[model samples]
Target: MAAFTASVIPIVSFILITLAVRCHATALIEGLYCGKKNCYDVLGINRDSDKQDIAKSYRRLARKYHPDVSKESDPEEKFREVANAYEILKDDESRRDYDYMLDHPEEFYGHYYRYYRRRMSPQVDVRVVIAGVITFVSIFQYMHGWWRYNDAMKYLLNEPKYRTMAVSKANELGLLSKIERRKRPKEDVKADEEAVLRKMLEENVDVRGGYSRPSLWDVMWVRVVLLPYTLVLYVIWWFKWQWTYFVMKQEYTEEDRHYLTRKALKLTTVQWESIGREKQSELIEKELWVNDNFQAYTNQQQEEMKAKYAESAKYRRYRRYMKNHKPGPIVDSD
Candidate 1:
């Protein structure tokens, strides 16, 4: 009875394995470009044929069926069939998949996956694509930065405040002579004036934050190229931070204090700069660089905001509405 049971188990396992193989093969055959015809039969090659043998056979078949060269009645269709067979068998990976499909002709999904994967796979090298993308992004970023800088310059040129200052500076430098202005065409005179204003802005004005001059280092390609150096610097900074804050427990430096103050105010460098130098000086004068002072300042501001909100009619109306209305699901009626 024990022997019989063991024999029966082996037979059951064999039958299950055979069924799985058949299912896999069926799936692959369904996805073949040549329909139900075997690729090996199409290529006139045996199942055990090597790459060289397959290539040789393909060459002969291709030449015989080629529409341009062959005298065959259905040369186009015959050439296509030959090309399709060669395409499947040319690559080692694809050939292996084809061989698997032939061996296990029952798996429907596996064949579809194999077909789609081959069809969808990129022909270009991934690294080349990545490099092209980085280059494009860097160029775009650099161009965009310059565009914004130009817009800011245009604004400054148009504004009376800055325009008057620039005109004065140009006059002091003797760039806008009355004689030259009179002799030249009005268009030329206007151009010269614009040039002078641009020069004055470039020399005197210190543009900061987003409107600041674009640098190669800010572009994606440059950043990617310098990533290793940046990583090294980051590691050193981490070590220094650990030593300063944990090991030494030292007080913050002037730069550190400024950074912390900016963080406390929840301001980006651009936003902080937009506050103007006078406002910045006022904040610094209040000793906000000190952690305790910063905390107290924040608390005071929060309390002031709360008092203002309580007094506001808009806030009162919003609060009253929310309190009076209880959220509930909407009922549908026919």
Candidate 2:
């Protein structure tokens, strides 16, 4: 048991240290909802204290430890403690939480608040401690990049993962996370897509050099600016290649060309698949347009023949010419 406890001591120590800082875990359950006035009221000020009265009381106590006035060894520390309590009582939300805790005394008992205190208390299938810790740790990774820089050596130097552990203890105490972003459902995504499509149809996408990250023109102008930079860089690169090329000059073979080609076409799988689908859509549209155009041409020819046999002026001229030339009297009026 001693060995087990000994092995667990570091973890416990870290957890207690974590809980002490995060409000939900470190603070007394009563601290949040307590209506009890603090040390400041009992010792520092009277119950009927007004703002001026409170300020006067603080000034008196402050002077006692004023560091300039009081030479008492711990007088400065007492002054600070009184000052902190006074600040909290003055704030509105802090005062509300204080009043709330006072009103609800039975809620924070051993597991009542953690196991059943939340608005989401009904779906209590999983132990909140474990679930809350996991959620906190996952979110912590995304924030601050605080723990990402940690290495094995850093851990050896006596570091607790600050962001992750703080988040976990805070969650354990019922503090909601700040980092979770709300997401839309599938239906909402479709609605958003339609809205964007409507906006696109109304406006031109071509306004900003047309959606290609850099259009060909953009690339060309960038190249124009980069030309001098490119030359300067090339001179540096040439010296490097000249030095290295001589070393490998005898061993260089055509095989290096294949590796160079492979590097240029690198792209994520999603991008390649998206390009394929867009090309397929274009091919389908082209086929349908060609078919529609051919059918339209046939209809137009039939309409021209019908008009020639009827009474339009241009058709009338054709009919007159036909009759004069003895092909047959072309019909006139419909």
lDDT of each: 0.83, 0.50
Deviating ranges (above 4 Å) for candidate 1: 1-28, 33-36, 45-56, 67-77, 102-108, 121-132, 177-183, 273-295, 303-334
The digit string of per-residue lDDT tens for model 1 on 1-334 reads 9999999999999999998866654643544756677788899998889989999999999999988899999999989888999898888888888787666665657777887888899988899999999989989999999999999999999999999999899889887774366566899878877988888988898888888889887899988989999999999998998899779999777667656667768899788778887777677666775688988888998999999999999999999998999677888976
RMSD, one per candidate, in order: 6.7, 33.3
Model 2 stretches with alpha carbons more than 4 Å out: 1-37, 46-50, 71-73, 109-334
- Which candidate number has the best lDDT? 1
The local lDDT score (0 to 100) that residue 15 gets in candidate 1 is: 99
lDDT for each residue of candidate 2 in 1-334, tens digit (9 for 90 to 100): 9999999999999998776556333234433222233534533664455567767777777777776788888877766666766665555545444444444444456323432344234645566776676556545533423333223223322334533443345455443333233685767665554333333322322211112222332333345557898899989977866676575575333343322222333434344334565553443333322446536645777898897669678778888897888766689889
Tell me the TM-score of each prediction against the true structure: 0.70, 0.24
